[model samples]
Every structure is written in structure tokens, then in C-alpha cells.
Target: MPTLEPSAPPSTQAAEKASRALTIERLQEQAALARSIADRLPWQLAHFDLDLRCRFGNQAFCDGLRIDPSALEGRPFQDCFPQDALPALLPRFMQALGGEKQLRLTEQSTPGGAHTFTETSFTPDVHDGVVRGVFVETKEVAGRARVDDLAQNKRRFDLMADALQDSCIYFLDPVGRITEWSESAHRLHGFSREQVGNMHLADMAAPRVGEEAEIGIDDTIRLAIDRGQWETRGWLKRAGAEAFWGQTLITALRGDNGELEGLSCITRDMTAMKDLDRVMNDLNAELDRRVTQRVRQHTVPNKDLDIFTHSITHDLRGPVRHINTFAGLIAEELGENASEEIRHFRDAMKRASQRLNAMIENLLTYSRIGRIDLHPERLAMTNVLEGVVSRLRQAAPDRQIQWEIQPDLPMVVADAAMVNDLFTRLLDNAMKFTRKVEPAEIQIGCRTESDGTCLFFIVDNGAGFDVAKASNLFLMFQRQHHSLDFEGYGAGLALCQRIVQRHNGRIWLDSTPGHGCAVYFTLPVETAMAASGLAALGC
Candidate 1:
């Protein structure tokens, strides 16, 4: 009856007290969990009270500070640091304790003679919304920073080696086992990293090394170690079982103390260079041989021509002088009775001699053209054509011809006389073939192409040719048309093609059975100019 009167229920009081206890327990659990996490973290963690006194620390913090937890507890943080250093760090600690959640800072320490840089974070520790202490986590960055610097230096060196183009760079151990190989080394030696490592230099030299040459490798290594470098050129064996001449420069790698540690071998493939040198030597020898052969072949022929020229001048002159003297005596002795038949016979003999002399002159000119070296020069096509046309008009006064010349024709490089002869021969053929036409029409022009090539063309409304027989056009003395129809020895187009080839150009024909023929030829401008200069001076 007394409890039921008006007193507060016991259950309500109990529930209020239980709620308060639960809140306290939760807070304790949270604090315990926070402390446990702070202790287990890899970074050094320490807690200082509001007064900047050390209250708690993890094992990592004790190890980092080089102090025991029992020795550090309740001690002022300033007391633990060096006397001069404490003042500089005190402000940051105070700020952290004054409810600032994070305070990041850097400090220097000289545990050894070397100074170390430490990065640390100071965090405020709070309980029930009250600033309790500062939790400090520290890490040593000096060792990691040094490792990063070394890694960066290695990357730079690797990049430099990869960028090189010429020489192969690689490292070998003291026993001549491959250690490092670059891309250039792989390209030069034909051995990749997987195939090069653990392989001895002797194995790589197997193809080039005779049984007696094996000692040279050891000698080379010893010499490099003693002299700091060794260089040699010899044949080298490749991974693909191919062998090439190589020039190898091996440099000894040394430690800081200058003791030999490894070898840096740079091998260059000298096969192409050596082969080029051999080719040059062979070419020189061949040139000498050809000179000797030419002397042997032409000596007798040149002497024979000289003898023939002398005989024709001296021996033939004696007979002609005797005949003339006898004829003069007959005319003087029997002046009135000198027979007309005798005079006519003497005239015939003179004409025959003149014809023989003309034939000999033509033969000599043709022979000289063959033996003379080609001297090319830059020549205006219009000038050469005009000269040829002037000469042709004088030679044939009765022929009526229509000559069409292209304006501003491209310049050509060639021997002027040869080009003049070429045009003359073509003009003669045109005149001969177009005899059936009332008026002969000849056209000369040039076309410039996009590829910087110039095509010179000579077209004639004359006797056309069969397409199947065009191949015979450029052959010496191989005339598709009869001599009566073309009045040629068939040497003009042959000479033209040869000249074009010498200038690194080409010649071709465009013709049909009934269509007029067009002869097209090309000349490289730069090469033509150089050759023309030589040709003009007859050098």
C-alpha cells in the first residue's frame, strides 16, 4: 500500500540508471577500440595530454623514438626531444591539443652522421567531445627517398641506353656471363635477354674461335681488367648460327674502390664496312686489270691504223705521181693527137681516189666516236635542233619540209655533237620516208611530268613501223626499214638509247602501222648538267 501511494516506479529509476551505464560502457568501448587501432597501426602513434605530456604510445612509437613505453609515460614530450628542438615543435603540439584535428609537419634528425627527414602528423584525441590529447603518427622518409632517387637514376640510364642507335651495349660478369643486354645489343648480336643470359662469351665465339683461339678470350678479359679497356676486331658468331665480322670494345667496370667488378662490352657489326672495303679494293684491282687488257688489245689496232695512214699518204702518192707524169708527157709529146679516151680514164682514176678518201674519213670519224669518252653538257634543245635543221637545209636544197618545233623545250644534258648527229639522222630518215608525201612534216617538243622528269619527243609524219619490230629499232645496224627507205646505218637510235642510259634515263617509241612514229627520251636534269660540263671541254 505504501509503494502504490504516489512514489515513482522503481522500474523507471532503474531504466534511467541502466541507460546512463550503457552510454558510459559504449564510450569506454569506443576509446578501447581507438587505442587498439592506434597501437596496431604500422606508423608510430603517440598520445600526449592537454598539458603536452606523453600519456600513451604504441609499440611502434616506442621503437621509433628509441624509448620504452614505461619510460615515456607521463613524461613531457618536450623532455623527450632535444632541448633545442622542443620549442620549434611545441606550438604544433599545442595546436593539435586545442581541438585541431590534424597538424602535419616535417622534422630533421641526425641519428648517425647522416641527417634524416621525418614526416609526422599530429591528430587531436577527443573523448566525449572533450579534447583529451594529441595522437602523433610519424614515418621516416629518408631511406625510402634515397631508394626512390636510386630507382630514378637507374631509369634515366636505361632510357639513355635504349636511345642509342649505333653500338651494342651490354654487361658481362667477371666470368664472362651475360648480365644486362640492351635492345641495340640484341639487334647487333641477334641474341635476346632470355637467350643471352648465363651464356659464356666462348659460346658466342664458337664459330670464329679455332681450338687454339679459346685462350684469347681469357687474355682479353685479363687485359681489360688490367688496362681498363680492351678493343679488338674479329669474326663473331650469332645466336642464329650466322657469323659476321665484329669490332668489340670491352671496358672493365669498377667499384668505388677501383676494383674490377664486371665488363661493359660494346660490339659493332663491321661486316658491311669490311665488305665495302674489300669491294673498293677489288674495284681498284679490276680497274688496273682492265687498263692492262685495253692496252694489250688496242695497241696493235692503233699501230695498224697509223701504218695504213702512212701507206696511203706515201705509197699511193707515188703511183698517182707516176700516172700524172706519164699523162703529162703523152699530152706534151703528142699534143694534137692526145686521145680523149686516155683523158677520160685519168679523170675516172681521180674520182675513184676521192671516193676512197671519203670512205676512210667516215670510218675514222665513226671509230673516234666509239673510243672517245662521253662528255655530257647542258644544252638547249632548240639550239641543237636549229643547228641541225640549218645543216640539213644546206644538204638537201630541193626537199620541201614543214618543221614544227615546240617552244621553250626543256634543257637537256648531253654531248652537243652527238645530239646534233642524233637529230641529223632522224631528220634524214624523215626526209627519206616522206619523199612520197608532197611535204614532209617533222615535230620536236618536250613534256614535263609531275615526278620532275622531262620527256623529249621527235615525231614525224613519215613511214610508220610495225609494233612487233620496234625492239629492233635501238640495235646497232638492225634497221627495220630498208637502207633505200631510211638511208641510215641504224646507229642513231642505238646511240641515243645508250646516251639516255648513261644519263640514267630511258628511251621508248610510240608508233603503229599507219601512224607516224614518235621517239621519246628522258634525261635527268642534275646528272645531265654534270655530264655536259665534262663533255663540252672534251675532258
Candidate 2:
């Protein structure tokens, strides 16, 4: 091959040389820029290649170790820093290069025998599934104990902030400027931390035109500074979103020096509550305007409906009584001549009529309970329960029943007639269910709660039902037991529930199959005499 010189003119050679110099200059500029950026960082950071040699060291890293950055560069870490930390430090760097993406550790080193704790982050410089080197970001944990406390507190604080989904909490500088923000604040205002910095408190509110609407953030800040706290409720504009009703509270915070440092703001977004109130107001207005008129128009028909039901049932009873009377007369006249089948047919008709009458009576009672207005008065329930037990005893005179009534029961705020009726239905249930149990046991008692309400219970050792089906227990015609096993129309419990609800009370039950059942109910008590009396009765 012939020796070939650059086949370009002198000018061309100079231009090529000039291009190379410019490229090199640009690279130097980039390196300087990078160093400048690294030097401005607060934490000590450095990067190393696969050879464990320093690619770069920031100003903070060099200054912290009292080593020249230039001397540290392009030198193996072990040769650059010949100290005991070499053994502990190299392994962490190796771990990063060996495919461990992030290795965070707090290490203590005694270089020249001075204890220093460093929180080091060994992040692998990953490129396309390959770990090329390690980027080390080390922060000096100035006081390890204090840092620990801060970290723990920060975790707890984050949890609390997350839990407050509707409340936005933030910190404002002493001069009424926003300094810090929480996640809730970001969610509520749609403003990032960077976007809200150094913003005056007054700028947060939107302009409003109304005598009642005062959106002045300055006045709010002034009040907080003077009174150490302030609260206000008003419609607040959300960033990039619709306005919402907000309840905001601001309180002053003091530094360790006992000087005013910052203001803590807690703003609760009450959009749901506001919407509910608006809806309720609209509903009430509609009810007052339109519903009242409807009620007036329906008044005549409603009263006619009540009279129709009462009169029609009464008229039906007259026909039923005639049919029974005629059937009895036929049975007497044909006593010797009547066949067994005719007699059986007549008895069946009688039974059907009786059942129809019972259903009509029960329906009338249920309807009347809803239609009639209640007149509540304070009355001793023990007397009522005693009266109910006496009636139950008369109903089943042959059955030996044991009654355990707790003495000196509390007086309840209820309609006496309605309560007596309620107890009659319940005691009837207890006796009906305990028909099989010899010498059936029933316990009537009361319990006094921390609140003023008194809980009364009627426990019986009887055929109990599955508690899972308790939801249907108070529904009309919803019976848990079979009609064959127990004789009932299934309206007693439903009526009892209605009476309790009319008195603004609650009722529940506890029962297990083949064991026993207990019916519990609550009613408001008027005085200590009633509550204390119930409590004294082992309630």
C-alpha cells in the first residue's frame, strides 16, 4: 500500500481540526454544567463505574470527606480512601453493580476515629436490563435518634393525612403565605406542592359578590393572629373544579423559641353535606306547597275509606253470625236424621267462618294502629306487665305456667292502652310457643343503659326460632314457626313492632332452635325513680 497523505487542501485540514476542537469544547461545557448541578445539591452524591473507580464526585461529597474532587476521580475507592469504611462501603457498591437495583442502608464510620452516621442509597445505574454502575446518594443523618423520631412521626402523620379524605391540612408561613401542603390539600385544591409555594393566603379565595359572602383571606389571617385561631364557613372555589362549601379552621403554631412560627389550616370540604341540606330544603318546600294540597284533596276520600272498612266488616259479621246460627239450627233439627257427612260439612263451614272473622278482626286492629294518634304518658310498666300476665293466665287456665316478673320496673313514656295491648300480644306468643314445655317458664325484666333508655325483655323457655330469620320476625304475616306446630295469625309481632316504633323505641330478639327465646325492647324513661327502680331489680 502506498503511503497516503491527507488528500485535502490546507484550508480543509484546518477546518477539520477546528470542528474537532469545537466538539471537545462542547463536551467540557456539558461536564462543567453537570458538576455545577451536583455541587448545588444538599446531600453528598457520587457515581462509580464497573471498575469501582469514581466517575464523578459532587462538591458536597468531597467537602464532607475533606478530599479534593479531582483526586477522588478516576481512582479506585479503596486507594482514594484508605480507611476502615472501605470494607463496609465496597460491598454495598458491589451489590448495586450485581443487579441489586436499590440498596439503602445507614452506616456508621470512624474515619480518623470520628463517629459519623450516613444514610446511603446505592442505586444501580440500569440501562436495558444491564447494571453498568452505581449512583450513591448519601445523606448525613445529623442526629440518628432525631432522624429516627422524625421518620416515625412522618409515617404517622402521613397515615393521619390519608385518613382525612374530606379535610385538607396545610401549613402557612407566619406572614400568611402557604409554605407546605399535604396530599389532601392537593386533592381538594388540585394544586401541586410546587404550584402553591410562596402563594399568599388571600390569593386562595375567589372573588364573590354578596353581603353575606366574605371571601377575604386577609381578614381571616388577621383574626387568627389576634385570637390565635379562627373558623369560617363559606363556598370556596376549587382549582380546576366546581365550587364547594368549606369549613375552614386556622390555628397559630409556635416554634421551640415560643415565637409565632406558622399557621395550621384545616379546611373540610362539605360538598356532600351541603348537597344533602339543599336537597332536604327543596323536598320540604315541595312537601309544604304541593303535598299539603294533595293531603287536603284526599281528606274526604281517606275518612270515607276508614268508614267503609269498619262498616263493611261489621256488615260481614252479621251475615257470618246468621249463617252460624242457621247451621246450628239445622244441626239441632236433624240431630237423629242427619248423616255423618252432612254434619262434617256443617262443621267445616263453621270453622271457615270463624277463621274469616279472626282475619278481619286482625286486619282492622293493624289498620287502626296506624290511623289513630298516640297519647303518651309516663306509667309504671310493672303494673301493665302484671295485668297482661293475669290475662294470659286466664286464657290458659289449665296450663301450669311460671311467671318471673322483676319488681319495681321502670315507667315508660308510652300510651297505656297501646303498651298493655303490646304486652298481651307478647305474652300470648310466649304461652303459645311454650305449649310443649311442662310448667312453661317466662321471665319479665328490664335493663338500664348508660344512656337514659330502658331495655325491657320477656324471656321464655319455649320453642325458639333461628335468629338468622329474625329480620322477617316483625313483618306482617311472616311467621318463623309452622302453623301446625304453633297456632298464630303472624300479626302479633308486627303490631308489637308498630307500637314500639310509634313510641320512638327499638326492639330486637335472641333465640336458638330447640332452646329458648328472649324478646328485647327499648323505651325512653322519664326520671331517676323509674331508671333506678329498674336497675335495682337486677337489670
What residue runs in model 1 are displaced by over 4 Å at the alpha carbon?
Answer: 1-350, 367-375, 394-398, 406-408, 425-429, 432-436, 445-529, 532-539
TM-score of 1: 0.41
Cα lDDT of model 1 by residue, 1-539, tens digit: 55556766899999999999999999999988987887787778777887778888887887767887779888888776656444335555665776654333343446674445466667887889998778777876647677456556656876777766646788776657665677877777778776764666666674443423324787888888889998877777776756777777889987677655578888877878979999999999999999879986886786667566555645555565666567567657876675898777656666655544444454444445544667676788878888888988889899889999888776766767777776787677767667777667988888876656677788887778897866777775667777655565566667666556545668888877656778887764543346645454331
- Tens digit of per-residue lDDT, candidate 2, span 1-539: 99978688889999999999999999999999999999999998888889888888899989876878878878776764436445445555665677654333343546674445456778899899888888988887777687667566666886787568878898776567776677888888888776775677666765445623354677888888889899977776687887777888999886566556568999998879978998999999988989768876886686677678777877788888888888889899899789999999889888878877787787677768766777667888888887888877887899898899999998776677888998898888898899999879999999887777889899999999999966788887788988889987788988898787766678888999988899999877876334334332220
lDDT per prediction?
0.70, 0.78
TM-score of 2: 0.42
Model 1 residue 387 lDDT score: 86
Distance from true location, Cα of 269 in model 1, Å: 4.8
Best by the TM-score measure:
2
By summed lDDT, which 10 consecutive residues of candidate 2 come out lowest?
Answer: 530-539
For each candidate in turn, the TM-score is: 0.41, 0.42
- lDDT (Cα, 0-100) at 390 in candidate 1: 90
